[model samples]
Structure formats: C-alpha cells, structure tokens
Target chain A: MNEKTVAVLKQAFKEFYFKNAEKIITPIRMKEREFGYMSFDKVMVRHLSFQTEGDLRAFLIKEMPHSVYYSCAYYYEPTFAMDEKGWKGADLIFDIDADDIPTRCKEEHDHWICKDCNFMDKGKRPDKCPKCEGMRIDEKNWVCPLCLKATKDEAIKLMDFLLKDFGITKENIEVYFSGGRGYHVTVERSALEELDQLARSEISDYVSGIGLNLESLGISKRASYEKMQRMLPLANDSGWRGRIAKFFSEMEFECYNSNDVKDKMIYIYRKMKHKNFENFVGEVIGKLSTKIDAMVTTDIHRIFRLPNTLHGSTGMLKRRCDDLLSFDPFIDAVALGEEPMQIFVDHSPKFTLMGKIFGPYKSERVKLPLMAAVYLIGKGLAEVD
Target chain B: MGIEFGLEDLAKYPFMKEAGDYVKKLSLRVEDLGQEDYRPAVERAKQRVMEAIQKNYISIEISEPIVELLSFPLALMLVKAMNVEYIIHRYSLAEAIRAESLLKEEKKSIISYIFKSTFNLEPISVKHELFDLKIKLIEYLKRATHFHEPEWKLINRVVDNGFVYLKTHELVRLIREEIRRTIYDRMKGVSLPSMPKNLKEAVHEISRVLPPRSDKFQRVTPDKFPPCIIYTLDLIKKGQNLSHYGRFLLTTYLLSIGKSVDDIIDIYPRSPDFNERMTRYQVEHIAGMRGGRRRYKVPSCRTLATHGLCFKDKILCAKIRSPFQFGKKPLFKKKSTGQIRE
Candidate 1:
C-alpha cells in the first residue's frame, strides 16, 4: 500500500476503535493473559499486558492495529516458562475452514505459484509448480459460494455431532462465523473448563472421525454365497449406525433412487464381502465424518480472534451464529457501516453482500459502500482512488 | 441358587490372593454377598477400617489398589454415616495419588459410588503441588463420566505438567497395571462367553441397553423419561415378571415423580406373575408406608445395568442420576426460542 492509503486505513481503524472501544471485553482470569496485535509492517506486537479493559481499549484506539488477539490460555503469571505458567484450563474449541472443504470451485479459480520461479497457474494446486517443478509453492485460495456453503454444512454437521455424540448440551455451545472463511464452535461448559489438552483431543478426533475402529463399528466381513437381501436398519437406531444406514437406504449416491437401494447395497455388500467390504464401509465413513481443523481443538495454548471483533482480513465482524441453516456469511457478517467510498477495484468474482450484488469488475474505479470498500481494501485487491 | 464366597475364598482365584490375605489378616468381616441384607456386612467393614485407623496401623504390604478395594465399602459406609461432602484420609501422599488414579479411570463407577455414598474426603496433609494434583484429579473424575477413547499424549501432558508430582501419578499407573494383570491371569483358564457371530446386533444390544456414561444432556424435558422408568413401563406393557430390585426401582422412581400408590399398583396387575395382595404390600413397603419411615433413593444407573435392566437410548441417559431430575423443567427451554447458542 502507498503511504497515503496506509494513512487512510490507519485513520479509519483509529476512529472505529475509538467509537467501539466499549464493546470489547477481556476473557475470564484476565490478569494472566497476553495480548497481541498486528502493526502496519506486519510486525506482531506480542507479550503485551493491560491492567483493565479500559486500558486495553485505549491502547487499541491509540495504536490503530490491523487486528487484535488474546491468548486462549490462562496462566499464573502471563510471562513465565511453559511449565511454570500455571495452566488453568481452556474452552474446548473447533474450527471448520472453507479452504479445506473439497469442492468444484477449486478448479475454477484456485491457483498455485512457484515461490522459487514466480510461475503462476489457475486451477487445482499442484504439489510442485508445473513450469519450474519447484517444491516451494504457495497456494492462493479464495472463498466462493460453493466452498463457503459446503463449509457451513460441515460446521452444522459438526455441531450436531458435538451435541448428540459428545453429549455437549446445546446451551453450552456458541457458534461464530470466523469473519474470514469459516466458523468456530466454542464449548464453555464449566465441567469442560478444566479438561486437559488430551481430553479435548479425543473430542476433536471424534468430531473429525479419525482412527475409527471399523471392526468394532460392525463393518466386518461375513462369508455369504446366498442371494442376500436386506434393508439396512435405519429406524430405532442412533448415532453413526443410523446415519450410515439412512445414507445408503436413501440411495443418495444413485441420484436419489430411494427404491430398493438398500437391498441392492446389501446384496453387493454380501457378494463383495471378501474383496471390498472394508473399502466400501471406509468410504462411507469418510463421506459422513465431519472434517475439522484438529489443531484448533487440541491446542490449549491457542489464541483465537475475539468474537464480535472486526477481522482485518475480510473487514467483517466475527458474528455469532444464531441459526445455522439461515447463516449467510456475506450478509450477516458484514461489519455494519453505510458510508460509501470510491476505490480502484482489482479483480473480484461476482459476489453478493447485504442483499445487493457487487463486483465482477476488473481494475475499474468504482464507488461502493463502506463495508465493500473496506473489504476490497482489506483483501489488498483495491486501493484508495 | 445364589453363589456363596468369603473374602478368604477369593484367594483360590489367584488374582485375589494378596487382597484376600490382607482382608483375612485384618480380621475384616467377609459377609456373604449372596445375602439380600448385606447392609450389616458393609457396616462391619466400615467399623474395621475405623478400628485400624484408630490403631495407627494400616498394612502397607497391601497394594494401593487392594487397599482401595477393601476400603471402598468402608468409605461408602462412612460417607453415608458422616454425610460429608467428601471422604478424606490421612495417608501417604504417594498412596493416595496412586489410589486416586486407578479410581479416576473408572469414571462411571467412581462417580456413581461417590454420589450414592456421598463421600467427599480429602487427604489430611501433603505438599501443595501434589495436593493440587490429587484435588484436580478428584475434581476431574467427579465431573467426567463420559466414555471417550484415551489419548496417551494428553495423559502425558498431565504427567509433564505435574513433573514434580510424577512419582505419585506413576504409582497410580503401577496399581492399574497390576490390577489389569491380575484380571488377565484369573481369566486365563476360565471359559468366556461365546463371541456373537452377528457382532452388529450384539453391539447394538449393548449400546442400547447401556450407552457409555456421559455427562452431556439436554435439560430434562417433559417427553424425555429416564431409561429405567421407560424399561419398566415397557415390561409392564408386555406383562413381564419384574425382579425384586426392578420392582423397588420402579416403585420408588414412580412415587418420587408424584405417582400415587394406587396408580403404581394398578400398572403391576398387567404383569403375568402379578399377585394383587403381594404387589400392593411390596409397593406400600417401598413407599415407606410399612417399612420404617425411611424412604430409599432409587439405585444408581450402574446397579440397574448389572441387573440387565437399563435401557439407555436417549443422550440424557449419560448424565442423570435419578428419574426425579426430570420433574418439571423442559429440556433446553432456551433452545426452543433459538437464541441460546448465539
């Protein structure tokens, strides 16, 4: 960014923090927390402390940081050795990233660049840059409707699993749009407050469906030569068993045939028991299991972006999700501001925000709402006109 | 026919030799577990432990796990007698921590016993670090009843963080290992139940009847009933004969939920083995109309499972202690409005 644009952004940040300083609140056991922020040159200002929320708010307004974060961990003293830092406990958290969701949008716009050779190509990222065959490559990912929607579905699925399988009550859980490209689910039950990293990891594994014992799950092979016909039991069952049964019985793989699919699968399963039973069942589990960022859940020492705070990357609020089904990130997560500003647009896909269409423009100077302008500027795709 | 065995008799099983010898040497009363009135036996165990404590001579030869096993009934009895928040003992810090770890791993059993026995004892004196570890472990065990696959790395984190107190935690592991080996050795020559060919059906039966204990639950809702009550209601609908304990569980559970004695007795008539005079008398006895004014709390979920009666299907089965928790509060009243999560 030019010095003039950087000055404008800093001024905007200062004004916003000054007006909204009252909204920020520190987490529990505040005395043992380490605060951090991003500076203009991407320098991380860490190991910072504040006496009160008021002090923290004043610092943010004065510094006009690009973003802010507080440690998820609580300690006896903020700056102490890892072992000496009395580990109190951490809230159980799960992250679902849109970039991780497998979808067709990747082929359309996702690209990779050879960091060594500067060779760029659009489409699915290759392990090594094709032109330079360089090992050091950087993946450039962008969020689209398909990928974001898929991630939302994954998040909802994970939420259901947490409630039903992990036995977490719905009331103890809070879901938030990550303000960039996904959602974060935090569990705040007092009972779970002191769960060590290990206990939380088991929860993460269950949510991600990792290291599942197939034989114990009743996916073992049986010798059967007879013409076996069965409707996989779906009714009066619960958990994974019921889910698997319903998925197969519903014939979702065969264009929703729903007619005799269970019988056909049963026949095929019995016939192919000696050869493909394990693979088939494994495939089903992979399809059904929730894909979550395991590190987020297990890292008791992690620092999560504070909820309700603005995310510098997308210029969106890390908004709480009230209803999973109706959460539209583009509209619901947009930071509330109505003032319009003119900006030089670079490249952007056709995107919808606040029930209005914007972009599909390439390098055009255009006037847009403050939120849109901030979003474009924040993404580094546009500059102040 | 009920099987009969004394504490000494357990020595013949090989695994119980050390445990049996200690009990015999201590002159602990080895009551006939087969008997219906085992209350006096447990009371005697409590008395013996108290006597030993008074004498200042608890046998150190007995392993920590064995000591715990012997002390369980005693601790339980004492907790009820004292009605304390927890049962604490003045013992070696190492021993206490070791005992706690083994007890901690058995989450469901420990939690149910702790609640039923009302034990809330802590160690008399210890280093602050080890004390904190024990207290944290105890608190963790009390709260954790859910069955989750153990991750050793996480267990190591506790060990690493509590490095100064690692010796105590290691002793806990040693006790666990020894107990496990004893069980393995005892079962070596014993004929095990035949493995089910239809493993899926078998697993389904086990999970349905006894879902792994978890603390998670929606607040008790109007439509959601405890599994024991649901199972008993199902049995009554099918006109099946109920066991003595089952009958007691049902009567106490129903009465506690405000069901009238007449209403409870009416449901029993549908049972194939129902005797109007006998059923009414037993129901009245449990309702505290005949049996001394003392009313009984419903048996713990583990006790229900041992009798082959627990029918856990709903997630609520994981957390609740008694059917009474489902009194009037609708489970997740806030969830109905869709504002709680946000």
Candidate 2:
C-alpha cells in the first residue's frame, strides 16, 4: 500500500470514530485498566489508558491506530509491574473466528508462499514447506460469502448455548463482529465478575463440551438400570435422557432409513444397547457442542478488539451484531469513504462485496472503492497504481 | 461417611416415600396450606419420626437412609403453626433451587436422583420439583414481573426445560429476600429434634443458598452510626467485657465499616482473655478467611436483642433494622462529643 492509501484509510477511520464517539466506552474504571493498540507500521503500543471517552476518541483520531484494545481485567494499578497490578476481576469473553472455523474455501482460494524455500501453493498452509520443509509460510486469505456464513453459524450456535444452557440473559451478553473473520461474545453480568480462572475454566468446558462425563447424564453402562428405566418410563423428564427420549418419541414410526437416523439425535438413543452407550454419547456431544476459544474464556486477563473501531486489515467496522442473522460483514461493516481508489491488482479471487462482484484481476489496473482498495491492499492482493 | 444418600435413596425407604409424597401434594396446594386442617396429621407423623430417632432405631436401617429426608418435612411440621403457607412454600422452593445449583456443580453426584424423582423426598427431591417450582415462579413473575425481557425470557426458557435458572445476581437477591421473609421468619423459634446428626444437615440445607451480603460503603462516616452501634463503640472505649457474641458483632461491624482485620483484632486486646493469636484467628474468621469463605451479614435488630446486647434509644431500636440501614440516609442530626447513649 502507498502512503496516500494509508492516509485515506486513516482519515476514513477518524471520521468513523468521530461520528460514533458517543458509542465508544473504555472498561469500567478506565484509568485503572491497561490498553494496547497496533500502529500503522504494525508496531505494538502498550500501557495506555484514557480518562474519558472524549480522551480516548481524541487519541484514536490523532494516532488512527490500525486496531484498538482494552484489558478485560480491572487492575489495582494498571501501569505497575504485571504481578504488582492487582487483578480484581474480568468480564468473561468468548472469541469465535472464521480463521478458527475451517472451511473448504480456505483450501480453494487461500494461498501460502514459503519464504524460506520460495515455494508456493494454493490452499491452507502446511506447518512446514512440502518442498524444503521450511517453517516460514506467508498466507493470503480471501473472504467469501460461504466462509462468512459458516462463521455466523458458529456465532449463532454459541449464542444459543449461552442463553438456553448457561442461563446467561441477552442483556448481559454483547455480541460484536470482529473487523476480521470472527465474532466476540462478552458476558458482562456481575454474577460472573468474581469468577476465578478455575470457575471460568468450568464454563469453558461446558460450552466446548470438554471432559463431560457421559455417565453423569445416564448414558453409560455404569448408569444404574433404574436410571435407564426412568429415562423410558417418564415421558416428561428433561435432561439428556429426556432429550434423547423425546427425540425417539417424536420421530415418525416408519422412516426405515438408517442413514437418515445416523446423523440425527435418535442415533444416540438407537445405539444405547448398554455396551456402546458411552461411545454414542461422545459422538452426539461432538456433533452438538459449540466451538469457542477456550483460552479466551478462561483467561482472567485478556484484551479484545474494541467495538465500533475500523479494522485496518479489512477496512470494516468492528460493529456490534444487533441483527446477527441479517448482518453482512461485507456490506454492513464497510468503513466510510466510498470513493474508488486506483490500484494494480497483484492477485485476488473473485469475491462479492457491497452487493457487487469484483475480482480475479491479476496484475490489472482497477478502480475500487476506498474501503475495498484498503481491504485488498491489507490482504496483500493489490498495491497503489 | 454420612450414610452416602441421595434422592434415589428414598426409594429404599417406604415410609419416607409415603410421607414425602403426602407433603409434596400438600405443598403444591398453596391455598389449602393456610388452614390448620392438615396440621394434626403432619404433627402426628413428626412425633412418630422423633420417637423413632430418639430410640436410635431409625439409624439402624443403613439400607434405607431416610432420616435426612424425613427430618425436612418433620421440621416443617414443627413450624407449621408459624405461617404454614409461607413455610411450606419457602422450604419446598429453597430445596428445589438448591438441588438445581448442586446438580449443576456436581453433575455425576447421586443428586441426579433429585432431578429424576417426581416426589419431594428428603435430601434431594424429585424431578418434577423443578417443574413445580417453575410454575409457581412464573405465576409470581406474571403477577409481578420486575425484570427486563431478556432476564424474563431466560428464566422462562430454563424453566421450560424443567430447570430453574436465576439469570442475574439481582434476581437471586430478590428470591433470597422472599425466602428470608417467609421461611426464615417462621422457623426462627420452632424447635426440632437436635440429637439426630441428620437434623443439622436437613435444617442447614438451604444455608448456602444466599450469596454473601456486601456492606462495602464507599465512605463510612462512623459519626453517623445508629445509637446502638455507637453505644457498643463507647463500651469498647471503656474496656468493658462484652460477651463472645457481642465481640463477634462488634468486630464484624468495625471490619465492614472499612477497618482492617488487624485493626479489629487490636481493638480486642482490652478484653480479659485476649491472646494475640486467638484474637487474630477469630478476627480473620469473622473476616471470612479461616473457615467458610463467606463474609458475615450485619446482625439485625432482633438478632442483637437475642444476644441481650442491643442498647438503643426507642427511636433507634424501633426504626432501625440493620447497621447498614443506619447511615444510609443521613437523617441523623447529632453533633458528637464522641459519646452516644441509648
């Protein structure tokens, strides 16, 4: 990207924040929490704090950092030594990203070049280069509708689990689309504020379905025969046993296709012949569990991308997902300034953005919108002409 | 070690099942609970159970550990005269809520029987307890729903699946207040068989249900203390020998008023038998460090009176309920010579 392109993106970001200044907020007790950001040169800045939203807005407008972040933790003295900064409590947050959500398109349009071997290949990068076994693999990922849709599905699943199972209400939960590929879900309830690392780890396990004992839900050989009987005897029971039982009772009598039942909830109950019940439970759990970054959920001290800020990498707003089902990151999250900028496309896959299709332009000069140009250049797929 | 029993254990005890089923049906009919019509029958059963416990014959049935389960309804039977409707509802609801929380924590524990059974048994009760509770709470919410839609919706969803979910800490506080006003008041003076080890467990079952009360004042103005607390401070200044309970009340009061635990311990040296280590330990324990990790709630007016340490003017004693409620409104119009009297 040229200096002019970066300057335009910066101006666009400044306008975005200025327009949404009232919506911006630092963590509670802002002066007591450490903030971090990434500069345009990609240099890291840490140990930052703003006394007010106005102060933070002024700094963001002045520096126009690529990304902004604040600590999830409330510290005793933020600028003190790490251990010396007494950690009070933190908001429990879960991060789900498209990068973490594996899609076939990643293998189709994404390309990785090994800097060490100068070897190139399409699709997901291997840990080591296939030709020379070198570890330095630089990757280029193109955003597509299919992958974004997959990411949204993951987000929906997570929201459902949090609300229905975890008993977290919508008021306490805030879902925001990360300017990049994923979504961040934050639980801001005071009930969860004092949760230590271990307690938070338990929540992580529940959501991710890690180490859940099947026997606990009466889906094991060790489950007393009486429990198994109760599972069948009563039609109204509600745990996993009831869920499985309800699934069986609700099914049409003669579907006759084992393939149809294989992937259904009935499969777990159908396989419960006492001996292999545990295996069935495990399989069902694997299919139903929501994927999340367990580390992000468990960490008492974390920094997340600030909401309402423009993501430098995508030229998209890190907007809150009020309407997740209808939220299109391509169209809805595009940053301000629609003026097309001239750039020579290095290489890019055909992608639909802003309700229009553009792409697959190899070494061709193209005039793209300011936000689109920034995104292409950010992905290393284009440069200023 | 304590006769490892769960709600499922009630199946082995025929008599407990019979009594528990009776109590569950009786409890569900809230309108019929107010009359003393069913009191005689429950009292008779409670007497029979107490006689069995005193004779030590009930403990012999290791195969049927029904003592804990039986004691719950027995205690309720004893306190039935003290507002039966309130006690029965509070006892049943508390037990169900506690079961849900415990089952959520220790999923593999035998408490699953509590989630499975339809009867409200002794230790952990039946599966339908959650369903019953949901019906009652939802009706209460419909009559007087104070929360936002998200909170209400979450409670509805959790209850729909036959589970009760307390969405926010504030909601939990609201429930606890209801419990305190109902059950805690009724059972305050009711006597039960104290000899059976299971009696303590049964009575204390819902003890951990309340979250720790926070008395952290942003800025405590000690001069604004209620006449009673001020009287106690004056006693401390004069090196008076306050009783053990009196010392406990004072130490906790001072600590909650922003005094350091060490500072609280130091104030106790004037006492006749103050050993540094003992004083420190007692102080820390009251501060919720050495024993259960729960801070002490401020002693209410009635509790202070029970200790016979309540020194208050007629206005202070009649109007104030708690120490925290004293300085909350800034209505005191006294200029102090640092001396306060009842």
Candidate 3:
C-alpha cells in the first residue's frame, strides 16, 4: 500500500501456507562448487521451460533422480519471463579432489584446499584403506573451486563484513540450509530497502572478489558447455555442500585483503565485530534507496571503472531492462555451476521495483539470488567458528 | 575543432570496452574507426551548403572540387542504396582509401571525367567513379538511417543495391582484388608458411577445408534473427582465438551446417582430448582474459600436449585449470615442461 518496499514475508509465507498449508516449506541452505562434470562423465544439462508442469518434471527426473524434491527456482520476473529461450547449462569445472566434497567426510578420501597459495591438493587420501602417498602430491583435489572447504572461511568473513557494513543485525538476518550443500543468509527485504542495487552488488562483489591463490570466487568468463552442465539443476549434487565446509575448515583464515575481516563474530558474548566493513556500511544505511542513481553513481563512480563492470555487456549479455518484470532469483541459482556464482538481475527477485540481491552467477547469463549468497556466507561463518 | 567525441567514447560501444585502453590497441580496425569520426563533420558541412543554396564554404562548393561534379546523380545515389546507421563498414572504407591511394601514387588519372569536369580538388581521372560510389553510399545511408529500428532484413536491400553499384564501373575488379588481398593478409599472419604461396590459393584452401557453403549461409543475412555463419566465420579468420572465437564460430557454424559436436568429433577423433585441453585453457585464463585477450591467456597442459611448448610449473598450471574443474585429476608431481605434441 505504501511506496516503500515492505517484505510481506509474514504475509507472503502466510499466503503460501494457506495455499499449501498441507505441505511444507523448509528454508534450504546450500554452498556448492561446480564440479564441472555431468551425469556419467558428460556435461550436465538443465531444462528451463515457460510451462510449469513440463519443466518441473524434467528437472525432477534429471537433478533429483534419487529423490523427487525441488527447491524454489527462479520462477518469477526477468529471467524466466524473458523471450522464453532454452539453454543447456554447463560449466567446465575442475573439481577439487581434496576431501571427497566434505570436511566431515569420514568415509575416507582426500580433503583440504589451500586458499593462500592457490594450493588445491591438500590432505591425505588413504590407499588400500590408509593414508596414501598424499602429503607429497600437492595440487590434485581441485574439483570444487568455489565451495572447496578452505575458501568458505574467506567467503563467510565477507558476509560478516557486509552485515556490519550494511548495518544488518542478527535479528534482521535469517540463515537456512539450502537442502543440499550450502547456506542461505536472508536479510528481510524490509530491512534491506535501504541499500541500492549497486550497493547490494558491491557487497556481493566483495565477498566474491576476495581472491584465493588456488581459484577465485564467481564464474569464469570462458565457462564451457560441459562446465555449465555441472552447474545445471538437472545434474544433482548429493554431497557438494559438505565438500565446501571441508575446504573452509582446512584453510586458516588468512587476511589477504587489507580490509577483510580476520575472525568470527560471536553473538553470545556480544563480542561481535567485523573489522573491515563497519565504517563504510554504517555511513551508507538509511540514505541508500533515497540516494538516487546520480548520488549512488557519485558515491561509487569508481564502480563504472572496475575491470568487471567496464566490459560487462559483452561479457554477460542479458535483456535490456525495459519493464517491471523481475527475474526470479531462483532462476540464476538453477543456472549455476553447482557453486556460489555471482549474478545480476535488473529488477528484484519478484520483479519488484526495488532490485535486490542478484549475483554470484555461474556464468554471465546466470543470476544467483541473495538467498543463495546468504547461505554461502552463513556456511562460511560456521566454518570459522 | 577537436573531434566531438573523446577517445573514451569508444567505451560506450559493446565491443570497445573490452578492446581496452583505446589509444593503445594495435589494430588497423581501430585506425579505420578513427577515420570514421570525420563523417559527422563532413555531413554537417554538406547540409549547411545545401541550405545556403550557396556555391562554396570558404573555397569549396557543396558538391565540387572533384574533377567532375554531378550533384543530382550523387544525391540520388545516396538516397537509394546505403543505411546511415550500418554504414559502409570498414571493409568498404578500406576500399575507398585504397582507391584514393592508387590515384595519387600511380601518377595517372583514375577516370577521364575528372580532368574535364567543372572544378577540381585533385587531378584524378576516376572522379566519376568516386562520385558515383559516394553518391550511392550516401543515398543508401539516408534510407537505412531513417528508420531507427529497421529490420536487419533491409540489409539485403542495401547489399543488393550495393552490389549493383559495385558493378557499375571498374570498381568491381578493384574491390575483388582488395578483398582477396585483405583475406590473404590475415591468413598469412597465422597460417604456416607451408600453407599457401599467394592470396588466391589461400582463399581456395580455407573455402575447401571448412564445411561447404549451404543455402543457409549463402542466403542468410543480418536481417535474419540467427545470422549466417559467415559473419562469425569472418571474425575467426580475422584472428579471434580458437577457444573463445572458435567456440562461438563452431557453434554457429555447426548450427548452420546442421552438424553436431559428435559429428565433428567423429571426423576428428582427437577432438575430445583437444576440447578438454583447450577448454581448460579458456577457463583458466578466463580471469586474465575477461576483458577479451586477457580471458584467453590461461596456461594449460595443452601448450605441451598440442604444441611442443611445455607450460612451466605444474602447481601454477593446476591453479590455472581451476576455472575448468571437472572432477579430479590424478596427482603426479607435475613434470617439467615436456615436449608432448604428437
């Protein structure tokens, strides 16, 4: 009823509850890395359709072959509604064979990926049921660069940075397991109306922008068809999130960025402090949405010059924003490479006038939601603790 | 006056931003664009003179200084053939530049009409040929630019008319020769010395090697939604990378040829190995190459497997391949650069 955005989460969920009150809606958290392979050693393919029944069936058959479960995919807004084009989502990924996709992978395999020296081959895989000659083999387990356990610590630290930076508090933040392999940290839409699209994206960019020697966060420009398959929703990942945690645990949080947070925030003792982002974020609250394009541009005019933003159109081509339609944030997740890939959507997840979290895309075409980003940061934080 | 647009204005275009710091890019293509900046000024001058109904601006007439002056025919030609927005692309400009170069360098008249015409800019023989081409080009632009969002289909009309204009004089022969040379020069830069002796032979070689021209490519054009494979094919032969450029080229090419990767792989058995290896490079280098060339610089085992060059440092190479992870590779202490090209 008002001009400002109000997350009728209570209302929306209540309505969802009324429609499917007999059903369940679990907040799923996930943090995955693109393994870069499809079912049976081929590229993965995810089907996208304008028809609800057809696409849902296809996705169920392919991605959830062992299980018949589906997450809330990008069904609303710009991505799903655009020109109705179908794509074979594949991302050529190099899987980190570090810890069998998990830190707690007790069944036995390798674990650990190094973020500092770009060291992927870490930990020991026992041969013949014991530690194999792994201590010497330094760089082999690289299947899941994005969610490898070691880097999650760095990933989560950035989230903490954003929380304090954006003036977001725990009461305002909600975390969930992505039902598969990641964490989803959600800040109520009502709480975040203060941040503009660019500000929100900068937060995304910073978490992802943090570079680890082994592999950087987000999608690669040269992602291949086969690579897209691993990220495709059609090819399911059963244990990817665990692999991400293992990687995070292995890497001791090393402060590489001059402004990056180096430790965890403990809410129990009120010993919560994110070293880097508090200042800038505190200054930006309340004045965000009202800032206007001119003001935002003036504030972060340097954004137009960042290497990624500069040649953006040619790198990641998407529809020109000419309407109010939003790209269901889930669409980007569905299009991901089984990891936290940054994405951008011109409008909000619901095609709301206020554009929200749309980033960490697996490819230039994919646009992940803030929900996935939240999980990634949450998992990243949990790893630190 | 300074060109109204700054060099940075190139950034606003889709491809230029990736082209990177405009002043430093080393390509004839960039130079050609620079020359194009002269067009708007030239257009304003022409329009002002037309409105004045005046004989000259400073010392030059609205349409004179060429050996022969046929204002009516020239204006009519412009209205007929070209689209102002699409313009005579660089290839055509190259044609125009080359032609002008010939007249001055050869010490001979380009066409007989220029010597006997009403006024003079240069003592060239082929003033009529230049005038006719310019007129036709401008007229074509008038129609093309008039419709802000004209269908790409109109390109066919322009090309059809353009072809007709090309046939009017000896210009056709010169263009063919220039096109042949341009094609040859590009290939010569890449194709091994053993490949071809001259331009004609080179064209024949590439035409023969690639899949045959189907009706789709022969007739398909920009007007069509899915453009012909020829445009992309042209980009590759012009020197885009085999991974980035090659993928886009192969996708459209296979689509046009109606062939699948499987079909091509069958023909080239080593394709899978090559694809994985090459794609690894594409992904690894993607970070360095995001801007364009930077996206293609990723080091790979492909350098050793396909080429004799061994990429030093196994850890570094693995890190590079991190962007292209697809399961895990068996770790062997990465060996030194080995000559593995088969």
Q: Candidate 1, after superposition: displacement of residue A308 in Å?
A: 1.4
Candidate 3 lDDT score relative to the true structure: 0.27
Q: How many clashes in candidate 1?
A: 9
Q: Could you estimate the TM-score for every candidate?
A: 0.54, 0.53, 0.24
* Number of the top lDDT candidate: 2
Q: Report the C-alpha lDDT of model 1 over A1-385, residue by residue, as the tens digit.
A: 6676677677777777788888775666667776678876688866666778788888888887777876767777666656667788777788899877788887876776788999978877788877878899877676777888988888889876766544567888888888888998887744666776545665565556555543333333562322233214342234454566666675444333446644555555666663576677668777888888988887888777777677877778787899978999988888647687888987666777788888887889988887887777887778886
**Candidate 1's C-alpha lDDT?**
0.59
Q: Chain A only: TM-score of every candidate?
A: 0.85, 0.87, 0.25
DockQ of 3: 0.02
- Ranked by lDDT, top first: 2, 1, 3
Per-residue C-alpha lDDT of model 3 across residues A159-236, encoded as one tens digit per residue: 443343333454544433222222233343332333322233323322232111111111123544344223221111
Docking class of 2: incorrect
